[model samples]
Target: MRANSAAAVLLLLACSAAATAEAGGGPAVAAMFVFGDSLVDAGNNNGLVTLAKADYSPYGVDFPSGATGRFCNGGTVADHLGELLGLPLIPPYNGRFSVGSSPFCGVNYASAGSGILGDSGKLFGALFPMERQIQNFQRTVEEMRARMGESTEEFLSRSLFLICAGSNDYINNYLLPLSDKPKAYSGAAYAKLLVRRFGIQLESLYWSGGRRFLIAGLGPLGCMPSQIGAGNSSGCVDATNRLAQLFNANLRSILRRLNDSLRDARFLYWDTYSTSSDVINNFSLYGFRYPHLACCGVGRERGKFACPPLLPLECGNRSEFIFWDPFHPTDAFNAIAARRAFDGRLQRRSPMNVRELVQLPLRHQ
Candidate 1:
């Protein structure tokens, strides 16, 4: 179901594209680079020690290879995106860049529980910091260019970088009672600070010749099963969701501004929020039955020590579930959402979908 080789992925995409073309399907993309938290994370957290791991038993139960450290029993949006782009599933950003080490096609910098602000925490215990992740990117680029020389840009330009973060900030750190309350960033103020930091980090890529960016905005945290489990009877957390909206709002403005200023740098905001909601709103169409309860759980989704551990009730069919855990999605749900993103059905895509962000030629106008 998931292909790890870029060439394999390309083959799948090509086959899928040909099938779609014959049967009247949608537009196909080029490449994909997944970055962010557990949402888009493939197995990037495998190298890091994060409490957000789904590598334990029952986590990857649905996965073909069993536990692979992916939050899902299987692949995430990154895997689906690679298939969508017609390339092999990219490898993690750390370690030696080898087919055995890293897939050598795309790089996944996402560490489980890593926040956009490079949050300090005990969960992941010094997981790859956002700044450090960027450094890894720069190092990778230098290394790639060293290997590929001029052909590097030709290869990279067609790729799509998918970034999904800031969830841990809202759900794990700032929300937890045991968390150290940082007065520096709270609510909208915190969102702004994150936005600013993101811009600075992104500038590093822009100046370094990276162009397109598929900036995946935060999904509605309040609507997540975890948020509901966190004690909100409305089935959705307004305050938490508000924080996500606040982040997305700033991101939209910031990206447009960046694109305007840079002229050629295409920074597109992938509306993970809206696209994710399509599933919540219409689950049956997507083959999901329980949109609320996670496939693997410690009973009815609320209470403590329920996740990544033994649960009273485990769904027989994870494919019928929308949420895999309180935070992560099932492989089926991830597949639907990712395909939607690829199809540009999120209403956030422009003349070019979020995938085309990297394809835009960048020049500081």
Candidate 2:
């Protein structure tokens, strides 16, 4: 079952005192600002003219509002995190925030198909690249300062900034034969390019007052049903998985460097790859029966396309499936992952878990 609001509140409140003490006596997590791609996107892609969207039926069949552009079958990692933080679901920065939005709980700047590089998602369509997302965040900070007259820096320092990107850089750019990226750059070169850009982005955020960061690493893209279907193989694609590992290694190094340089900042790396692969390899252990196929979609592996509308070909037992669509995890999996991030001691999330991250005493540089 999902972690409800009350459960999340209870969980966080129990540690709130400790967190307050740790942060040199400051407020508990004030807000959670999210950035990156679709894995954490709430509904940022709803109005976008991109093919990478999930604002339709069977996408949110289990959610209360239904199809809020979330790629998952229900709430996303952001939603689960919000509930854990005792805050309402984080709103997308595009639609609602475009017209005088509030950053009370937080704002989600993640857009489906976005990448670390501006041109990464260009081949797919007009998606919000990481640059644009950061621009939006700057706009948000300005707006908050103008309206609330509050100390934006202080507020942001206590907030949690979550980042989850890099998948599309490989999935849509480096791996797509039609794209010229691969021809222009080798896999190793591409990874370096992405990491350099990512560093700039994070550095920009730090300059903008962001201090608490939870950066999620790339997941096992090779194991996605789409890749599995494309290869017609019984297992995941090794080549693509290697790309993810390379990027993850660089990311860990980046975090270490950022932590060392930005003395006041706390950067925690969430190992999405390891956590997800665990579920994929041990589906039955995680109460999932189908790890290789999506509950929605149709084809040799039921992953050639997105889930159709009106529930056609949709699985009734969505909870039993690890993947909801061709390329996204179901709400069940997202919940499990989110909860683990909140308190799990697994090696996937290190230095300190999300719970410890929230309670960390504020440090000013």
Regions of model 2 farther than 4 Å from truth = 1-25, 97-103, 346-351
Note the residue pairs that clash in candidate 2.
19-359, 22-361, 23-361, 23-362
Residues 1-365, candidate 1: write the lDDT tens digits: 11223333333234333433542332233345566776665565665655666567776676777776678767788787777666666656542334342233566777777776666444667576567667766665665555557745644555566777777877777777777654656788878888888888777767655667777888878777777776747467788888889989998888888878873567777788887777887888877787677766553453224354555445777788888777788788778777766666444445356444333333431
Q: How many residue pairs clash in each candidate at the backbone level?
A: 7, 4
lDDT (Cα, tens digit) per residue for candidate 2, span 1-365: 01222232232232333344545655578778889888888887877777877788777889998888888888888789778877667777665432122224577889898899887777668788898888777776765555445555666777889999999898877888788887888778778889988999999999887998989999999999989988858889999999999899898888889988986788888888999999999999999999888888877578888787765755888889998877888889989998988887634434368888877675643
- Local distance difference test, each candidate: 0.66, 0.79
TM per candidate? 0.82, 0.89
Best by lDDT: 2
